[model samples]
Target: MKNEQIVLAQRPEGLPGDETFRYEDTEIKKPDNDEVLIESVYISVDPYMRGRMNDTKSYSKPFEIDEPLNGHVVGKIVESNHENFSEGDVVTGGLPWKKFNTVSSDAVNKVPSTEVPLHLYLSTLGMPGHTAYGGLLEIGKPEEGETVVVSAASGAVGSVVGQIAKIKGAKVVGIAGGDEKVNYLTETLGFDEGIDYKKDNFSEKLAEAVPDGIDVYFENVGGPISDEVFNHLNTFARVPVCGAISSYNSKEDNGPRVQQKLIKSQALMQGFLVAQFQDNAKNASEQLAKWVQEGKIKSEVTIAEGFDQLPEAFRNLFTGDNFGKQVVKVSNSLD
Candidate 1:
């Protein structure tokens, strides 16, 4: 089989342009022992993936120039020599950006498709959902009737965070870029209030939304929005820095540079990866799946059809053009 892959053409200096990525074609090798040959179905495009576009090293290694950029993907196994997998099994994992992948069995998880749709494995039932769960419960530590705010509240992780906060009995407020997303947050996701960060009176509006002050701040996008939220934090508030997406492409990352607020409010600020709380991540996914099944939590997905749209789908995440979880639908049928 011939595989088409999206590669990192060069390290991005700031916001990635069209020149940042290039496409290449290669022949798909057959699965070796303990390996599986899978055809891509759903390709996840995320904000954190932008951080990997730079040459700098952080918790996750940078994507190499001229190499395939990999992220979470749901695929159907066509061939397998592994003990745990078989032909025609659906699975999800961190896979290379390609039409077909021959991968080690240990890297992929067999997805049981009795309940949710296959694409949910790339969104609400996947990594982004897990990130929201672990980050909010473990680091943010929200309590009943407390005010909780989530940035980028219309995006995948942020949307889940706000909904979960509401589930926990906290008064949830969402900070989004536009009025459409603000409406989605308030009407669809059931957030108590939604603030449009694009407005000139954003800080004042956020202040009005959270009159009691913020007890838990689920930090997704970090920039002017974060700086404004910091000013309204209550004493002993918790801040979970899940993703600094706003600063991902920039070389200098001064995350929420409001030192005085931190010092005065005695707020607890911690940055965490979902892997830090493995059990929580597992519980989060399971709970999110159940909540989605129960109609208690809404799962939103924005897919750019076909593998050919991968590059543009990814760049749209940085530009805030995608409303919910961004993924590419590689196949018309998962079967």
Candidate 2:
């Protein structure tokens, strides 16, 4: 059998374009001891992946030019040399962007038997969900009756963060780019108020939404949106820095310095990675799953069909073309 893979053609300076990716086909390799062969079902395309495309040092190692790109993937085991896995066992892990992957069994986690769609394992029940759960609960720590503001609130992590805050008895205000997404947050996601940052009077609307001032700010898209939020922060506010998608493609990141705002409010601002809370991953998953099953939390996914759509799916993240978690449906899972 042959496997097709997407590789990083070169390091991108600004936004990655057509020339950044290349496709190649090669013979599928057999799994050795304690390894399994997986056929991908759903592949995740996330904002953090853009950081990896840069050659600069960071939490994740930069993707080497000409090497196959890798991220979270939901797949089914086709062949297994590992005692723990069997043919057709669904799993999720960090794997190369390929039609098929031969990897160590230890690298993947078996998807629990649940009615939730397998694609969700690459979204809400996966990294995005985990990131929202850990970051908000650990750092934001919204209290009952407090006000919580989440930027890019219609996107994967921010969407989850808003709902969780609502569940915790806080007034949730979501900030997005358009009226459609703003409506999704207020009408569908149950947020108290939705602010469209692209509006001419965005700052004025944001000020009106959080009358009591923002107690917790789930920072996703930074730049001007974040500056407006900072202006309305109450004393002792908590800010969990998730990502700054606004600056991801910029040649130079120029934004307001927020040290004075932090000092005046005495707010706590911390940046985090999901792996920092690895010890409580199972507990977080169990809690999130329970919330999801009980309808206390809802997950939304925007899917692009075919493995060929991977690059486009990834590009959609920065473009706001995706409403929720953006995933590529590479193939069908085993029945």
**Candidate with the greatest TM-score versus the true structure:** 2
Tens digit of lDDT per residue, candidate 1, span 234-264? 9999999998788777667665567789889
- lDDT computed for candidate 1: 0.88
Question: Among these predicted structures, which one has the highest lDDT?
Answer: 2
In candidate 2, which residue ranges exceed 4 Å CA deviation?
Answer: none
The RMSD of every model to the true structure, in order and in angstroms, is 1.4, 0.9
TM-score of 2: 0.99
TM-score of each prediction: 0.96, 0.99
List clashing residue pairs in candidate 2: none
Per-residue CA lDDT of model 2 for 1-335, tens digit only, reads 97899999998878889899999997799999999999998999999999999999999999999999999999999999999998989999999999999999999989886478888887778999999999999999999999999998999999999999999999999999898999999889999999998899998898888888999999998887887889988999999999999989998877789999999999999999999999999999999889988898887899899999999889999999898899999886653
Query: Candidate 1: misplaced stretches above 4 Å?
Result: 252-256
